[model samples]
Target: MEPTVASRPDPTGLNRRALLQGGIFAGLGALVATAPFFADSPAAAAAAPGGPEPSAARLKLTKFKDPLRIPPVLRPRGQGGHDELTVRLRTADVTLHSELPPVTMWTYEGVYPGPTIETVSGRPLRVAWENHLTGNIPVTAVDFSLATGPSPDPLSNYPGTDGCQEVPGVAGLPPWAAVHLHGMLTGGGNDGWMENLIGPGDVQLSAYPNKQAATTLWYHDHTHHVSRYSVYAGLAGLFISRNAEERALNLPKGEHEVPLILSDRNFGLDASGALTGRSVHKVEMVGAQRLMRPHHGPYTLVNGVVWPYLEVEPRWYRFRIANTANSRIYRLMLLADGRPVPGAFQVIGSDQGLIDKPVAVDGALNLSPGERAEVLVNFGAFRGQALKLVNTFQGVTPGASNQRNDLAEPDVMQFRVADRKPVTRFALPPVISPTFKRVTPEDLPHDHPHRWVVLVGPGSANLPELWEMEEIDPAGITFPSAGIVQVQDAQGAVKTLRRTAMSYDEGRAFTAAHDGVETWKYLNLAAAPHPMHIHLAHFQVLSRENYDVTGFDRVTRGSARPIAFKAASVLEAHELGEKDVIRVGTAGQIVPGPNGTPGELVTVAVRFPVVGRGVHHCHMLEHEQHMMRPLVVSPAAHLHRGGAGGHH
Candidate 1:
């Protein structure tokens, strides 16, 4: 819900009133068109009066259109900019009800777990996104009622391709969104061009700065307009950035180091367990509700499975954990092997990648949306006990009773350590490290070749200005303005237009891929603290801004997301390390790389690479697809790069 609103309608006068009618009440002709603002939650409850019998999770077909597929992209890994990615947007049928969603989703590449992306820092990537839509663009309420009733599970893929240049599991959709690789240090050139979210027949290209501490990251739509709903309907995948520098660490490899991308979803199906289309020819109301676990699902999933199990041997293991939930935090812990056996958690990396020193924690690790953390668990002592990785984050959520009551339910998995251990043993070292590779000020010819971008959100006060500027596009009203902005009250038949910046101050206009170091801050002014994760480079939280109490003595308040964080990575350290995304805490103050030291503020010490560029932006899928800006990273040395799109 980035601040993106129009005072009036686009050249196509589809004002808030029209937008609401289409999204909530379909086929209402004129009566439903009378009111502009959408029906609030109470209204949704009122619309349904008394919901159907409170049943356990069931499968349904929220959308059974087609698949959103894309081409497999392979770019030569390096410390430069963007690699190449070919993304296709199509539609498909999906059956997911059981505590997932009642709404349809238009994903990048079809399937629950979309396609995979791999690149190196500095190697910019070019993704050609082609969108194809069938039903209404934003998927109005009318488009969903097509389902007669609910049915069985195991949803199926769409029918024949119509020769739709198919790409395995991915297809396309109506509403379009550009890809944003959250956390990459690339420039605007490779950044996910969120402003370019198109409809059928539209295409776009973007890049990134793949330079950073080598690690695993992710990519998703940054279209803040439909952020929540879009991602809830499935539109997220992983970004793998490898660096040759850290290979000597001798960390877990092969099956030892595992990447787990976790998400929660519910589907919609018909009474006969069929792929029910969008709203029936006519619709009533369309919106979000808490059917399963209230605001978030009580059931936890590791790599899309409920209480999935994993077998672990008596050795060191690298676990990459990502919290992809729309709004759920996991306080994770490993039920260490019995006291007889030696057991402890070693911290190798964080949201971005491996940390310089591996810290030790007794138990309980936390993970938030769009955040990634890498750690090692030693099972030498409990070579015989049955251990489990669990989430003790009970009260953290509102309605977690369902998952809390079932210990095995909340239990992520189990580990059966091998009876004997010998080869390749690992332990928490006082300081784990990486090969630093940051560029010096001298390396960057221009004294001020750096770029300064901010994450901005236009408040309710800026709707008029936004409309006046005509930045509003043709797509119907997307945001709650259903975003992180002040929810405006609709008076009478007129609706207020207040735009919010999904990821505030996205200075795409200013971050056109640079040739060296870069620094930017995600300044959020909304009430809700968002998890700001970047791709490509692993940046440390340099400093936090202290806020004074407001109202009392004209004061403000201080805030911090993932509040546990102390200091962030340094300039030289992050430059040479391998990291994709960094968790920009809610403090609203983000400092890239190590500390800025004296006389410096909001500066990220980024090093220029010798190859292509990569992308850097928010990982929150929905936030990215809408209006999040793009960034590009270039090299210091003079050179010409062939503007080759991801063609083949």
Candidate 2:
């Protein structure tokens, strides 16, 4: 029998108590452990008609199963931004080494590493994200709240939680996550707010208004605590937003335009394709073998093929590249004439969207997970020549809080130039689209009404007498969910984070629309630099505020503190108009906070979708679901459509 979406936990088998301790731990532990393995792992190796190695067996990894075989481009689903775009997620089993049994996976239409979503920028789009699972986050009934007391996390449990979370549609899995357009102006309320999770039988609304930045934006699971697990467990993919204006640039269109989704994964050759991981500190890993994909792996897959190959025409091609790997960073380089293709890709856009001008790279291109780039490559110059796409992110030395860049040898795929058929276009446009303006600190437009929100991390709670715990909880979980983490290298500076089930900020809900204009600040107390993001809307970097004040006193003495902005280097960051994601720098370069982390970042104005609903959370899916999800949107025409909880 197939696994039902929402089956009651073996009611006849066991009552409540036992399910809580065993099922919850087993389910969460499995989710957390299996995540990193699927980053770029592909489904079973189909025959490579025109490809590289038979399989990337050298690198055994996990990856999202490709979504149902849907065409890349699709029509808008909702009248406004909440339309439904159909995406089918399924799973299959794969054979492997040893006498291990086959591992089962919840796949995308039966294939790993789901499909790419191609659409236009500025135009509203909806995605009907469907979850068809053989198994899921166990459906056991378990309470996920912090044992007690108010969570000091930046996020508030009740704020963004509309009402949707009550129903558990999928198996007992934590509400994994929904789609969040990485770098585009989208709606706030339905922006994949972490709390608005969906299940097998249930559905959640992901609505957003497009600011028309006309750039490359992507979609991935943004669950707070489970982000590292979900994305790693094969729940990530691509999104392309285009605009009429961008079309006029004479860039590659239709077939010539390609979206190269990059990712990695590690899977056990046995057990129906279930993943296995050895965390740095999971109490279980002390004896188990849950390794990070980077630390291991011999082969690489491009578009779901180990050392895969592709056929390209000798003409100017627009490649929308997305690095969907959970932990690996890929420094992409085209190997032309044996050696690396020197300065091949001229990057035109990044995570948020288009860069003001195109920037060319020599030898290699570095891409971190969740990062994307749009480039123009003239295949005409290298027609008939075989190009090997190589991974170069694995250069960093192992051991540390930082992720791995050791994907260099993880050669993704190959591109062969068939004889160039005569075509009108010979070269790519020197420039893609007209430049977008950047909002500066001085004289910015005001949003409808603004409330100061602080991006706080659970600090002080993690502080201990020894100054540094040789072994600390990774995120404060037990057993398979190792909670021990390495402390930041601040030396003797006291650092403490409240004991948390998850490491992300607690979400706080906010309702009220900023009629198309408003400035907001994102203050961060977490030690790490989080790539902060919001759906349905693009925001400007108004200024960065760093205050040395702490506690209630900081807000009280706020008038004395000032905010400032630095010249952003990331070309795409200068959005003359609105955008999706913004890099909120840490405290001090622009401002300081007495809490030792970033205090606040003044943001540019934004416009909610016509219906007004979207999500605002950390771009890092792992952090968002755990505790970083929030619901902030404009006044809605169909407010009651979603309810106090949410659409799901």
Candidate 3:
């Protein structure tokens, strides 16, 4: 049966017109004052826990019935020192699965997952991102008022009409777009600032220097407040940077190399309980508050195909895997005949570039949202066998009672190895990148800057907050002081800190001197894990420690001194590589100190080579729209004659 839109009553007692008119959750201030943290709101009382379930039409769809789609490579107009290209953002009707009908989506160049743009390192590539979108945005179930009430930041005002004046005639507002090249080292003007939005008929020209090492980077919509909706409507693509250093390795090329872009979506149902063929933004009730949580559906998409399968030759292949999901964290593993494949994944690189050496991963590889991994898999051993790539990570909605596994997909995709003889065997290199060097504290200058960052949540209406921390003297600190937290320093001495900046508009609290190295400590105080991403810089994980989250008094905004300062195990081989995004405060078990705490404190070292203004925030698109802040890198001060100060 073909999926069609039904004229059924809205399940959450909120219709499309009402949602666009900003009727639902309009009285957010009143709801936050009277509602409990986990209680159901009147509007969503009839909704099931963990939001709505997939419709009957969607549930009947089979898994791995369709072939995987490889996004076409985008051709550049010119070559040599510089290249120019134009990418159009427009609406298209795409058939996501064979079982479902064609759904209208806002895509880049009229294709889902867009097209892959490959470039040579050190070359300058200029792209004109043109917006040609028409009509209302494809996503309808979004909560535009979630971050509305009583926020000083202008970005917090969702569906704000001020920014929509350019594009008229659409319900609520026309689609706005700001293309961001994730993990690229570029100037602040071309970095896709969140508020640099362009409506229909507008164009945004960006130039990427591509001076960083060869690696995998992606481009996605980054409009403030509406990014989650735009990206979900299909506006993302991969940009690969290659150089002679990486090509000399001869790892995998041509048909042997593949790009796997992973994403998830949930379809809306009509009045007849049939699929509407439209992506739905899920909403959950947490005690008198209707909160629109991150969308996680039963359908899993790989390169725009739902539960797709790939036919691989009986040889070694390179896979560049990227998790583009808004909020899902995939613990990916390879299995054959329902059993684990030992050393299936030989990871060679991370987000930024190649690691020092390839690490064989016999277990699962944890990939958080916005994270990417370059893995090499050998299919020669399993020539006639079919392998399955699965996600073992079970996701849980924050504050939702329904811990239903059905809502989260376990099966990602399938790999059917062809039954054929090997053409030519390639030996795996021990040292993938001979030039790669690990960053250590000894290499940094003495008195390098150290910054503190904290992730806290449920501040107002269950919203998550990212805070810039300032250290204070513990001499006269009182216990249970409001907005103050006590933690153990690296020397096992007690240190008091206070939250400084919580909003995006807050003046830049983090500053670094050009060519200077800095260390940052991220403390996760919230229940859920946050993939903290720093812009325009690649960092190395210095250390990780466990903390006592239960000791944090949310009411008093204070925390106990005992953060259980103990050294964690050595960093994972894949983690040794440079990364732009780091998962903080995961639920995984770590080495605990005297007190078996449940929080995480991660420390990382970064060297700022680019002088510009950029923003850092959680990679989860929903959280990023609300929890983001600015960072600035300034020119180093001139040294005096015979002065002790010098560039690191």
Candidate 4:
């Protein structure tokens, strides 16, 4: 059978009495002892391959009872030429909701979602990220035994086999962290290398040149193996870069602007069946492999508050939204008086910066992990009426029935339009970014560099792997394994390719010439969708095409064949803007066969203006820790063969 996407528990189907009788919610120890019971249950059998889905009983929490929190903007101590500040990663007890007790979390600057740091374009900023966290991870569900080990049977209760050992410097050591500024262009040394970890009392100083355009960026923990846990524990913050051009547009400013940092989380239950308030990291078995699925919780946090409500004046407001979830993809839509409100907001910017013109959001706006969007919403017409920000995303579990789970919480937040007069009246300009230019294939130099990166999966332990591919002549090539694929180019010419580096430590597989543009084609051959993120540069999505995957046999042969390319019109209008992350692979589709499934090919055009080493991988924190690769950028004259391009 083929590997399936991880399935979430049906919140309504959870038997509270049965769980109590089985000692599942008795305590953390009892929960572990009762793992086999759930593994054999129908719920476990239906489990898929994404992230962990805990019981609704454990994730119980009230929604929309508390006011939303707008993180305070950090004030730089220095000004003019360069700005500097200090951010500390420490543990604190935070009140996530009004009814629930304070939850202990590892935070940046002692708060969840941290404090927002603002900067100016062309200016420079420096930060000292201090690691003040001490003790084991805050999440109760962290299983270090599964960190580095062979696959374990779902029916067994043993933590692992005799060969199962913990990852050194992570399992038993004090908490460590490495911070990465997502969507920021900087050198690798300052880009937060995964393995360059810092322990308690240690600080990792980073400098940002701020040469790029004003955009929405965020910083989070990037430690090699523990990033998933650290980020879930709340070590994340917003970094906004501003420019004169954006200011001249007269967009909403000061009190009219808000930052919406979205995240989802599940709370644990204690022996008394009371909410523990601490976050939980649950794992499950998929086939013969023990997998740590991406976490999706019952509670939706907007700016660190669960299902919060934000009061909006009767005026146009700018909302900078960032999806900081560990895995969940939010399909957001605004509703007034319980009816869909189309064209209620206009998207002005994407991951990198403002697009050429504002794209009116006709319906729902899809935001995957690590992606950001800036929009302008006018609440003038809805004065005295309440609006709801809801998620219409129904997750997909390949090879399973496609149905919306009623128990899934769709309500994200409530927007209460106060019956107040507008502070000022202003109209949106026709063009928000006059300097913005669209990038096209024709603009590239002749014979521009190109690289094929494929997302492969279910390799050893049912986990996905990223492959840096190189094409070879098909004259004498024979199908040997599943990693090999045959792709048809634009002219209908077929080419054979195979996987190169499969892990982060394998070696650097991609190299780009400084000041030159390269087209990177990402082919996803996995059952789940991957939001691929590239560091040190922003890229434009050229196109997305669907390919046939029914021929590829994972057990016996490699038989992937590219079908006639079809444009994916589902790409949103705002997506045309430059981005640092792009979603690829099978999105929301049930697997048609047991051995193979359809795939998606996403092509992007990236220009390497900064020369240094950097990494790229799925923004899904779990996938990134396991399936990431490194790349280097240097001058064209110094580029040599036998690296990423040598295979051809």
Candidate 5:
């Protein structure tokens, strides 16, 4: 039987008495311990030809031993006025598993979470990113048909026809390399265009003003259609912008601050016992043909180490946690002896910068892919106790019902609190970055555009192949894809938008007036949640609305019925702060509407202060490679100029 999307938990069905008695969170440990383990089967081997087979014997649960690896800081190597930094992209062997050999990985400066680029907020940091990798690309297990380019008819078996494949004599092609400063407000050329890739021996120089506020940003490979594979092979790093205001607060500093960059990978060994990256794809038999599906890995790694341990002092320590996983949602919590520690985490900052006030959270902190959280954990009370950083959401792929039990992915990293003070030089502040001004509904202009961004995926339920392109006009207005948009009239009957495919270049997706705040309603039409991210500027979520999904799928397939949209609650505490990436729930997961099951709708207000070109789309690198759309934030003065391609 085909798997159905899990419905949202009914609030009225929850037992308040049991939760108050600590039965809910306490029962989680028992459930994980008693969960069943499934070994590899014959059918599983048939699905992935080169991927790692899921076996019960490969489970490394509770195997925390080695010390956590801290990435080295990449300081500028020039005089005060001008700062110069250079990095080389080369292949390095990294040992992820104790039993397995070191895996050959593509990294920047020969490190997984490559050297951290630390710079001041306003300092000018210019980087010369060099590509030194030669010969065949390290990752081999990929479906070329899923390339970001337009797909050919099913009858044609043309290789390299997809947007990302290599074509003979195509100047400056693979061994391609590019860097995208995620969450950095920079110019268009330095924004890392997927089309502007450099080959081996070529160096791409980017000048970052570091004008944005101090925060934990990241840099990763955004090289054309193969980014999903390049990043999987380890070409990513952390970029931190430090400022004086953040320093005066006296929050954890120096040794007390730790950067926890999280990611997951699957490894396979070759003849010489050398480890190689493995890619997994689900195979489904559609009639007599086979189709490949996208999936997530089984092993989780923190700072390039698999289930590592950290020795910590019994004091307040600040942890900058980043979820670098390709497609996993982690509800992270600090567990002491398999039970949660009350009031352990004090969330002080987020992706953009520090919040107005520190939020004391005692429960799991939900984080999707590409999301970052600056949290303070006071180990002062847990002296000599072993605390485990655990993830509660357990699912291998999208749309699968989440098993709260974490038997398979229980511990992220273990922290052994010291019995004595290692040196208490820093203390937690009552308030952090108190000067942050939140952009509210009242702050937006009355002329803000009410735009709708509909997330589309593969129409077939049997395959995980996503819809490769979005409907965009040459003039930069994205229309809903045919069969995806439905309208209700006065007669109370649903009508579908006329299905028409229009050819548009990669750059033309959306046109937003410069310095103008716009409200965008992101409606997920797919069967799973996507982390929608906007480049160039941060955005504030206005509210959430519920819309019909069961009717949407049917309407997109020619079945139309009346549909009604309902208003949901405001943003949650964690979501109230400024964020560049937001997790949007799919259409079939919410409560059923008059038409049928509805998807969740998130409305966010955004404004681009700088006039330039940039793109905004899903942060899920897998989906972004093929399904993301671009944005042209034109200056107010540029609107009076030419229509298409005016920014250039």
Candidate 6:
């Protein structure tokens, strides 16, 4: 088959809305118009023609027949000594809809979610990530323009292609692979540097020290410029780092504890149950270039099954919930037969691990992409009730509504309460891990460095600048795409923050001292809130402050009228634990286009536990592809501390 490319439209008399409506390409437009991709699927049939139509009623009312598939737990290879494992990246076919044919997917070990890797803290392991993928991308619909790039690095040495030119599939790029253990503090070589791409037949070996607290970490593809598509094709999984302290808590285990990997997927299938070679791509007219913005699917998948149901005994159950969606934000709540169940949810842990105590969730649990919430629900009271986990946030498109407040995309999964057994072993203590220590500003050393992280928006008048930060090879890399924002200090000095200039320039942006506490003030300048993700170590949120956005622009210009600042609410219960991902601002509340949320600021205290190099980027995979930059921990700054957050 010949490679397909979208023909750019003439911009003479076009407006952004007109372009979004129909300017991608005559072929793509025809396919979208004629395709009833989700019409046959019950979960997505109620969505509007253009996009997801938020429907609380539809979610609360619909009942699914397929039971939820729980991902199998993958334990370490060896019991005691150094463990060695091999994770193969390859292609497989998965069934999303019961009636539809299996959709061809790129996955780790051929499973939709790969497998849940369970390990212990202090038990280190090594993995040889092998890439065994080749041939054309199976999906028919793609914005191939965004996937291609210049020459790839020799380190990413794929078998046969020259990096200098475009290849086939999405973005005319070959399938390159890199594995990132999202929240692990391993060596610089193991942190899944975005520039380190491995292609077909290549093997990349990395180590995990497992030195951090017992928390839920994840692994996924981080290949330069292709992370969004790669992960979308299913190269992601959960890694549970446990320890004696956590095991002693005696929480639900063996069929009682579950890992709920949540995500939104837009899939099209042909009659043969294969993913229709086409995808749901949304285009935007930015400046003179038309860019394909991130796509949000109408269907929600739990453990890779669409709108599935799970049988649960009428007792307390522990759920480790992770939202892996590319862009969807979930305001998760539980409903019974179309009505909201009040005070039914309790959170025992945040991203890093078990909190000092359990906090009752008064309303829905709000989780963004890459955020995790460990929740407990007691069905002891309603043994026979049918409850549905639902999402109410309706920002399917950025800065836009779901049309008429219609609940078009809220259904998650269903839970049918089963008969209670004679004995109930587990119980929720009013306080959990009571001795859990909380970090205070006074605990920070006097000489700790205070850093500034600013999240910016797309650049004005530069459409090509919106694509992924180029790969490392000088022959393939582009210096400046779009500058997300400028990082500044109290003295009014500014540094433009963009992708790394060179692949190997580890200290391009900033470096952290080992074992030193750094106060990171994240100024959210983008219109949408970004889930700022820091690798290597988890951090504590200090405080959030809102500024007079309009006045701040002038303040930066030397019009010193003292920009008014407002301290927001105190840290909530769920946010008090160690965290690696936090939404820096209120999503969808800021102005649209290349403007930053000059008024919002989120401050966090981060301590680099291990000496390594990693990249800190927005967790929204689409944004990260275009904006992530390198962060390094110098070996010279190594200091022996008690442990990361005193876990030792």
TM agreement with the true structure for every prediction: 0.53, 0.58, 0.82, 0.82, 0.75, 0.74
> How many residue pairs clash in each candidate at the backbone level?
147, 140, 6, 11, 3, 24
Query: How much lDDT does each candidate structure score?
Result: 0.41, 0.44, 0.71, 0.70, 0.61, 0.61
Q: Report the lDDT tens digits of candidate 6 across residue range 517-543.
A: 788877654456678888876798878
Maximum-TM-score candidate: 4
Per-residue accuracy of model 3 over 1-648 as CA lDDT, tens digit each: 111222433211113464324322121111111101112344533221112223223255566666666665664545557877777787767767766777888887666787677777887888888888877888755332323431122211111122212222223647788999999988778889878898899999998888889999999998887777788889998889898999899988876898889998767656666666677654332334434444455567888877776767778899999999888777777888776687889999998999989998856788888989999999888876678887764243211112232233466778877667865668888889988888888888899888888887567646877888888876777777766777775587876788788888874447677777889999887766789998867898887776667667766666754454655645555677889988887633232343343577988998777767888899888788778898876667742224534333
Query: lDDT score, residue 178, model 4?
Result: 91
Arrange candidates, best TM-score first.
4, 3, 5, 6, 2, 1
Per-residue lDDT tens digits for candidate 5, residues 1-648, read 111211322111113343224222221011111111122246633432222222223343335544566765666644468676777776655555444445556777665677677778887778888887665555534233433432322211111122223223322225788888888877777778777887889888888778777799899988766776677778888888889889888877776788899986544434654434332221112232233233345556787776766767888898888888776667777877667787677888887888878787746777788888888888887777778787664232321222222124445777877667545566667768877877778888886676666665454443222222233322431333344455443345543343332112433456777777888767665556778888776787777766655554432442244234554644544576778888887312223344433566688888676555677766676666655656777777677677653645
Q: Candidate 1, residues 1-648: lDDT per residue as tens digits?
A: 111233422211123454343331121111111111111245433332112222233322121111111112223323233344455554543322222322344544433344445555445556666665345333321112113331121111111112122222122234666666666655444555445576678776654545555776776665545555455545666666666655667778766766566664332235655534331111111123211111233334454333333445667777777777765555566655322122356666665666777666543455657777777766555554456555554333321223222221344444555556534556456656544333334544465443333333223322101110112242465332332121111221212222322233532222223334554443333222334444334443443342211111101111111112223333322222344433333321222222311111223444434233333444443333332333333443232344432112
* Root-mean-square deviation per candidate: 18.2, 14.5, 12.9, 12.5, 14.7, 14.2
Worst 10 residues of 5 by lDDT: 27-36
Position 121, candidate 6: lDDT: 79
Backbone-clash count (model 2): 140
Write one digit per residue (lDDT tens) for candidate 4, span 1-648.
111211333111123354344332221111111111012234522331111222223245555555666664564545558877677787766667756677777877566777677778887878888887867777754332243442332211111122222333433435789999888888878999888999999999999888889899999998887787788888898989999999998899876888889998766656676766777554333333565545555567887887876667788999999999888777778887667787876999999999998888866777889999999988888777778888764343211221122225667888777666765577977998888888888987779888888876566656777888888776665665556778775567776777777878895558888788989999876667889998877899888887665555666435545433444645676687989998886434335354444678888999887778888889988788767888887777677565644444
- The regions of model 1 sitting more than 4 angstroms off are 1-110, 119-173, 198-213, 267-295, 336-344, 384-386, 392-431, 437-528, 533-538, 544-648
Kindly provide the TM-score of model 2 when superposed on the true structure, using C-alpha atoms: 0.58
lDDT of 1: 0.41
